[model samples]
Target: MNNQYILLPASPLFIAFSLIVAFVLNLMPWGQMVGVPDFVALALVFWNIHQPRKVGISVAFMMGLLMDVNEATLLGENALAYTLLSYFAIMIHRRVLWFPLRTQALHVLPLMLLAQAVQLVIQLLVTGKSPDWFYFSESVVSALLWPVVSVLLLAPQRRAVDRDENRPI
Candidate 1:
C-alpha cells in the first residue's frame, strides 16, 4: 500500500472541529505576544487548500468577523484579509498539493504574508499608526509551522498502515 496515494475522505465534522479549535487557539492570551501566529488564518488556509468546497470564502468571512469582534479591531479588517487568503489559497491549491510538506510551507509563506500585509495596511489607514517591524514575524512563524499543522489536520484522514485485503475502499 502506498501511503501517499491513499487517504480517507475528510469528515465534515472533523473539519469543523479543527476550525473551532483554531478559533479557540486564537482566543488565547498569547495572541498579544510578538510573533504569535494567527491560528485561524493558518487553519483557514489549510482548509481552503485541502477542502475548498467545504470551507469557502463565506466561512473565511465569518471567521474573520468573529476575529474582528474578538479583537475589537475594525469589523471588516480580518474579513477582507481572510477572504483574500481563501481566494488565493483556492487558486493555487492544485499546484500546492503536488509539493512536499516543506515545499508547501514555502508556497504558503507568501499567502500568510499577504494576509498580514492586508491587515497592516488596513490598520495603518484606519489608525494612522504603524505596528513595529516584528509584526510581520507572525506570518513567518505561521509558515514555519505549516508542516506540523498539515500533519495534525491530515491525521484523521489517513488510513491504518496495514491494509485490509478483504475490504475495498
Candidate 2:
C-alpha cells in the first residue's frame, strides 16, 4: 500500500473512549469560572484532524447537544458552535497536521475563537445582546490547552516507524 494512503493509526475504541472522557471532563464542576476549557471541543478538533472520516460534523453536533443539555444553556447553542468548529478543523486538518503540536496550537486558536464566536452570535441574536469578552475565555483556555490535548490524545495512537524491508502485505 502507498505510504500516503496508509491508514492513520487510530482505532475506533480509542476515539470513542477519548470522546467519552472529554465529555466527562466538560461536565465536571468548575466553581463558577468565567469560562471553562471545553474538553469536547478539544477532542473533536483532534479526531477531526486525524480521522475526519470516522468522526466529523455529526459527532460534533451530538457532542454539542450533550454539552448544551449538560450545561443547561440554550438548546442548539453549543451544537451550532461545535458544527462550525468541526468544519474549520476539517478544512485545515492536513496543513495543521504537518506542523508540530505546539505550532498547531497557534493554527487552531482562531478556529477555537470562531467556534466561541458562533456561540456568542447565537446568544446575541437570541437575547438581543452581545456577550462580554469573558464569554470568550473558554476559547482562550481551549487554545492554550491544544498542544497538551494533542499530546494526550495522540499518545496511545502513535506508531513506531518500520524502516526495514516491508513485512507481509
Candidate 3:
C-alpha cells in the first residue's frame, strides 16, 4: 500500500462545533417563530457542499429525526426534508463549490425551497391543512445567511501545502 490518504479542508471538531452552534441558533428564542432561520438546515447544506464525503444523507436524516422529536412534528417529516436537502447537496456539490459565495447562495436557495416544500407537502398530507405563506420565510432567511455560515465554518480551515504533513488538520 502507498499509505497515502486525502485530508479534508475543515477539521471534524470545527465541523461538529459549527453544527452545534447552528442547532443553538435554531433553538434561539425568537419572539415570532414565523421567520426564524433554519440554522440547522443551513449548517447541513454548508457541510454537505463543502464536506460531502463526511456529512452524507444519513447524517442529515438523523439530524432531522432529532429535530422532529424535539419539535414534536410528524416523525419522518423533517427526516424526508433533510434527506432531500442532503441528496440535492451531494448532487450539485461540485458545481456549487465552483462559484463565488453570492452565486452559491443563488444556487442553494432552490434547494432550501425544495426542502421546505417537502415539509409543507408532508404537513398538508398529515394535517389536511396548507401552511401559510409565512412558513417559507425561513427558507429566504436561511438563504441569505448562507455566506455568513460559509465564512464562519470555513474560516478555521486551512488547506495543506503538502499532503504528507497533518498538523492544523
Candidate 4:
C-alpha cells in the first residue's frame, strides 16, 4: 500500500489585506483631484490571474459587498459587477494565467472596461443619472496599473542555488 498526503495551498491573507488597503484608499480625501483608480479591482484581477482557486467568485463578491458598505453605495451595485467580473476572470483564468504579462494586460483591460460598464448601467438604473465621466476614467487607470500591481504582489520567487537541492545541471 502507498500512502500520500495531499496538501492545499494556503488561503491568501494578502488578498484580504489588499482589500482593506483598497477601502482605505477609497476613503482618502482626494477631493476631486488626483483621482484614484480601483485598487481593489486591480488587486482582485492580479490575484485571480495568479491564484484563481483561492481568490474566486465568492471572494470577489464578499469584497464587493464590503466596498459597497464602505463607499455607502447601493447594496448590490458593486456586488453584482464584481461577481460578474470574477466569473469572467475564472472562465479565462487558465489562458490568462499562461499569457505573458503584457498580453495578459491586453486581455484584462477590456474586462475591466466591461465591469465598469456593468456598474455604470446599474448606477443609471438605480439613480437615473450618469456619474461623472471621471468615474469611468478609473477603469483605464486601473487597467494600466494591473501589470505593476501583479509584479508587486505576485512575482515569482527566485530560489537561491542553495535552496534548490534537487536542481539538475
lDDT of 3 by residue, 1-169 (tens): 3223344467788878887887777667786777787888899999999899989999899989988987789998988999999999999999998788888999889999999999988888889998776988888888888888786676666445555654533
TM-score versus the correct structure, for each prediction? 0.93, 0.84, 0.85, 0.81
User: Which model is ahead, 1 or 2, in terms of lDDT?
Assistant: 1
The best candidate by TM-score is: 1
Candidate 2 to truth, TM: 0.84
**What does candidate 1's lDDT look like per residue over 1-169, in tens digits?**
4435567778999999999999999998884688889999999999999999999999999999999999999999999999999999999999999998999999999999999999999998999999887988999999999999999999888765567998543
Which candidate would rank higher by lDDT, 1 or 4? 1
Clashing pairs in 3: none
lDDT leaderboard ranking: 1, 2, 3, 4
130: Cα error in model 1, Å: 0.6
Candidate 1 has what TM-score?
Answer: 0.93
Q: How many backbone clashes does every candidate have?
A: 0, 0, 0, 0
Runs with alpha carbons beyond 4 Å of true place in candidate 3: 1-8, 159-169
**Candidate 3 similarity to native, TM-score:** 0.85
By lDDT, is 2 or 3 better?
2
Model 2 stretches with alpha carbons more than 4 Å out: 1-8, 159-169
Q: Model 1: how large is the Cα RMSD against the reference?
A: 2.4
**Model 1, residue 142: what's the lDDT?**
96
Best-to-worst ranking by TM-score: 1, 3, 2, 4
Best by lDDT: 1
The local distance difference test score of model 4 is: 0.74
Kindly indicate the candidate among 3 and 4 with the higher lDDT. Answer: 3
Better of 1 and 4 by TM-score: 1
